[model samples]
Target: MHGRCISCRFFANDPALIEATFPGLNVLSSAYGSVRSDAGICSRHEFFLSSWQRCRDFESGDNEGKDALLPVEKKLIGYSIGFGAVLLGILVWISYTFFPTGH
Candidate 1:
């Protein structure tokens, strides 16, 4: 058993990972920010838990795996933002052309 959920294999608190796993969590709510400080999902238990919570079935994950996945997640986020920006620009242009305000 792990002393805390943060160190457990099932706990996923990394900001990039969280954002990648649940699209729009960062925009809709503070998943990694202080508003949910160190809280993450416990996949084994199927619960949203704080870092300090203890788990009886805790298993140490290969921390290196977590680190390795970070770069990929970050890239995904970057691409998503870039795509969103392009889409938004297109929508704005369409709106302005179709329903231009008197100026």
Candidate 2:
């Protein structure tokens, strides 16, 4: 059995990303926290597993459909932008109404 979970292929659906980040996870994927922070459903164990987790049932899997996905971060970024825009609009309206120019 491979000592490292990353070598077991069950490590990540997108194994390439895991491999690339394994060397320098601290510098590359710092925004998402640790490399192991990424979690996915492990087919072998029929449960979720972190990228850094290892198990006896680990087996090689393909990465055809799997992608280096970051859905949560994407959604959060979208929501933040939307909320900021709304706040900026409100600020502009408030300033215009309270500080009307003398015409």
Q: Give one digit per residue, the lDDT tens place, for model 2 in 1-103.
A: 4343544555454545545535675465542445545565454566546556667675655433446658998899999999999999998888889877832
Across residues 1-103, which tens digit of lDDT does each residue of candidate 1 receive? 4557777788888777767777777787856578878778889977877888886797876442344557879899999999999999999888889889832
Clashing pairs in 1: none
lDDT of 1: 0.77
The 0-to-1 C-alpha lDDT of every candidate, in the order given, reads 0.77, 0.60
Worst 10 residues of 2 by lDDT: 28-37
